[model samples]
Target chain A: MKQKIRIGSGAGFSGDRIEPALILAEKGELDYLVLECLAERTIALAQKEKLANPELGYDPLLEKRLIGLLPLLARKKIRLITNMGAANPIAAAKKVREMLVKAGLNLKIATVTGDDVLEKLDLNELSLEGNKAIKNYPEIISANAYLGHEGILEALQNEAQIIITGRVADPSLFLAPMIHEFGWDTQNFDLLGKGTVIGHLMECAGQITGGYFADPLKKPVPGMETLGHPFADIFPDGKAIISKVNGTGGVVNLQTVKEQLLYEVINPFQYLTPDVAADFTTVKLHDLQNDRVEIRDGTGNKRPETLKVSIGYLAYFKGEGEISYAGTGAFERAKLAEEIIVKRIGNQFSEFRTDLLGINSLHKSTFGQDTIPYEIRLRVAGKARSIEDAKLIGEEVEALYTNGPAAGGGVIKRASEIIGIVSVLMNRKKINTQVTYL
Target chain B: MKLLEIAHSRAGDKGNISTLSLIPYEEKNYQLLCEKVSIEKVAAHLKNIANGKIERFELPHISSLLFVCHDALETGVTTSLALDSHGKTLSSALLEMEI
Candidate 1:
């Protein structure tokens, strides 16, 4: 049996930086490198692209990422796992196969599918968000149920070096490797829970490596521009050490790990995934003092019978326009511009909002700051039923340069259809998962 | 004293809910954070952005506090018209609270 296995995180979200991932594949002596690229709203956008072209639904950066890492991944014999398959895994795997052939590098690839459950969905089912029936939503785009590590594990067991999946739980992308390496039993909830904790910590790539934890003077980080990604060295007992590449820009300490522990998490006691109800509260962290932290004591119970499905539908069109004002009474001019735009097209859309960017735009609450800024930007946004109606908002704001506010410069306008995403629970047995090798 | 002096935070969003983690710079200040930072106080501080139920989860081992606010992101990021739809800045806003 191997003493330990090292796993490095490549990408956190869909648009994360690509250079740091290359650094991991080259320097980090990793057995497995997992790139978690999908976010909650990512697949929904991919679905729109798929509707336009059958083979274009996968992540746009799939080719770029593979082009850069395939040589190193092959040379290092490091297995790659990712949900870059977004809305379509088959096409993504095919693209990777083509790249492998062109580069004269022979690598096994596996594609996992069947997460899409639109036809299997019952319109009468209530959404977990607002308790509204699925039928009430119009223009449904896609519905993908979050799968577990079973699919990826099957591919790994089959000796597939590259595993591509659609809409699997983010942490499962990292957890599957542990199960495959250690030959862990499916029913071992405690081990699975500990593995899940490791997955959660490494899933966000740079977040735990001090990308989001930096502050000037208070919490100073050395290299903001070249922040390195993190990796976990896991033992057979499921205990792991979190660390980053040596001489890297970021720091992996107790605070960064603690912040990431509760990120997007409501209750630390029970963090529900498809594999296990992992308990984060029971987990413990130890700062090793040199960009390394030993984490242990993770536990969990059984997995849930139901799976969470993300449902995407067309909600409304949003239009926005912005113009800047500077020097001597700039705030007053911006306020006047907001008033003029609100009076012209305020009653047209269902929701209209006007704000001065330097003022109360971010937190709509009034804290009453002591000083007033000499420069401000007027922003007007509204939601409408049709694209044409939404365009009117920007057009009116543009008219201000010629008619309403004085010295209104740098006018910008945007109008796009908003895709509203919600979630619903589905029986795990109802969704069938399949894996195919390329 | 401002909460920023003792603690730092990061914001995350799921659906219409916003989750923030407040971790003290020193473990000794964890008790002070627990005493001063309450769900009611947090809801009052962010009354403009979030109006739904507020719940706090404690991780004494790590000496951190997590606050979950529902109906927070103005109907979530996909549909919300707010400039900061994901409520990413809400973490800094929460740090402005006086202790």
Candidate 2:
């Protein structure tokens, strides 16, 4: 049995920095590099793309990322895992195969499916608002349940070098490798929970490695321009050391790890994942020498009986317009512009919002009547039922330059459809994972 | 003193709920933070942006306090009209609180 396994985080999201991933793959001396790319809304967008082109539902950067990492990965014998197969794992695996063939490198690829439970779901059985059935909304685009580590462990058992999955729990990507390498039992909830905590900490990549933990003098990090990615050294006992690659920029300390440990978490005592109900209240972090933090004692209970499913639907068309004003009572001019735009489009769109930037845009209730600034930007945004109606908001804001507010410049407008997300609980037996190797 | 002097924070969002973690840089300040950073003070400080219920969880082992503010991200990330729909900047805003 291996004493320890090192797993590096390549990408936190779909659009994360690629250079850091390259550095990790080349120099991190990692056994596995996991890239978590899918967000709650990404799958819905991918599903929309798939509706247009049947073979194009994965992440757009999948091909480029594979091309950049394949040669090094093949030479180093390092395994890769990712959820970049946003809506289509099969098609994504095929694309990876094509890239490998062109590079003349031989590597086994495994794709995990069965997360997409749209067809099997009963909308009438699910509720959105209080007692409101999902069937009432006729515009759901995609629905995928969060899978566990069983499929990923199966892929590793098949000796697949690269594993692709759709909508698996983010922590499962890291936990599966540990379970595979250490031969841990599937029912070991405490160890799974411990591994899940590590996955949650490292899933965001730079966030836990001083990328997001930087302040001017309070918490300054060196080499912010070239922040390094994070990696974890896990042992058979479920304890691990979190650190970054050698000669990297970011700092790994107890603060960074603690902040990430509770990031997006509601109740620390009950962090429910598909594999285990992990508890973070008792997890301990010790600051070691040379930017390493040792994490230990993460406890867990049995996994939840039902898995959480992310459902995305076509919400509405959003229209936004911005106009700036500067010098000689700019706040008054921006306020006038806001009033004018609202007067022109307010009756048409009830969901409209107008803000005087640099003033009460972000925290309006507290800073609403604060001191006026010398310069301000007027922004008007609203949701409309149709694109044409949404475009009217921007048109009115642009018209303020010539007709309403004097010295109004830098008019910008945008209109796009918004995707809405909702969550539902599904029985574990309803969703069955299958793996395809190439 | 400013909260940033002794603690650092990171914010995350799930649907309309936004969570921010406040971890003390020195273990000695954890008790000070627990006493000064009350849910009422947080709600009062952030009364402008987040008008929802705020729940605080204490993790003494890590010397951190996690605050989960419900309905805090306007209408959530995908549908919110704000430039930062995920409420990522809320951490900085929370750091501006005085203790």
Candidate 3:
């Protein structure tokens, strides 16, 4: 007899409070909880941490989330998988061990990270040691081979109540537990695809359930402050019922699910991943009514030929500083402030670039930013191969508010550290993913 | 040669990062991607177009890139991404990057 597994998705995995996600997992009688954190810039941050200290660069959020979660989950006996170990799972796991023990929750945790070491692999041709097609570059700030779902499953089988990973594929966290609980074979492409899609839909947590939906979600059910992280209830047949933590602030509805489905999907007919690219278009979703959507008919196809690697490099110099103006004509004055700063900074620095980011521009998001607001918040950020050059930028930017037309009208914020930017020279290399339980 | 459109994205606090994938007409044409792309160069080029710092990230996959493309944000994309040797509309340039 196969075990039944349920799936849920929501956001807010990290923050001061995250109990709602855990509370839902407990209520739903779910066997697994998967969290997705870590993206491109995160990879860069992880790389920075790795360079600073290989022992600890993973997402700090997971640890905090686990403290609130581990005890409750240990009570439920639900297993978990997360890629929150942004750069170094081994280090993060060390912290997790302490948390579990401190929480008085006895549990085994598996921390997976060898992929972060790709930075040390010598790929003269840009081929990531694990991916054979990407071009290798002379320098990389961070590099990690996307791990497959099997790793997560292995951890679960080893009685690892909690699994902390550096950077497992986003969908793999949800699917791995499905593969484990249902005893689904890796060769079962159809079932694998079903699980993968479920994971994909839920990977963003609340994103699927109205977090980023084009439509609106239902009002206050439970756990609003929790921001609604997700959990899954999986059936042996590979069908999942997605939901969020109860009492959360956000709502999960049909539109939310649809929006997440369309995310990052290149070809609905050929959704690609090293594990298996399933045709999501073939899948069907039914409202099924009453806070549940039944996912069915997900067809699995051939796996994409390539695996992805996050290539990051130390920025030679990076800095962030902002200038703000208020009152009438303040916006124009703010605009001039940017030009004057850039012009003055340019006088002393060559190969320097400046950005005039407006708080309004940021608030509008992916659309027109200047439609409203007479006051503007400007941020001047740039990078250079030299730290010395970067410092000059901060000085010139400050000069604008003190000596320029907007003199003293602008408030300067603390500056950001100048860091070098790394680019990926495509490198594809082959990695032996075969792992044995330790 | 078959043309396939690809979409790539990354996620973070601001939200999920995405880009309209313009599949190269064929795989062999991928060589040109390297010719036209370099980290420092992409950063500089994006700055020229958006006049803002472009936060770029490398995506892992058989052959996919997940970029934030902070400034390239525009409406329902109207312009096709590929261009020709002389800077004409790209008719084809990627079978698969590696066939």
Top candidate on lDDT is: 1
- Residue pairs in clash, model 2: none
Share of true Cα-Cα contacts across chains kept by each model: 0.89, 0.79, 0.01
lDDT of 2 at A192: 88
Tens digit per residue, CA lDDT, model 3, B13-86: 11112222222223344444434444455444334222234443222112333233343322111111111101
lDDT at position A114, candidate 3 = 57
Docking class of 2: medium
Best by DockQ: 1
Better of 1 and 2 by TM-score: 1
Q: All candidates' TM-scores?
A: 0.99, 0.97, 0.72
RMSD of 3: 10.6
Cα RMSD to the true fold for all candidates? 1.0, 1.5, 10.6
Candidate 1 lDDT by residue in tens digits, A13-49:
8899998889999999999999999988789989999
lDDT, candidates in the order shown: 0.92, 0.89, 0.55
Order by lDDT, highest first: 1, 2, 3
Q: Name model 1 segments beyond 4 Å from true.
A: none
Q: In model 2, which runs have C-alpha deviations exceeding 4 angstroms?
A: A128-131, A365-371
- Each model's backbone clash number: 0, 0, 72
In model 3 chain A, which range of ten residues has the least summed lDDT?
A360-369
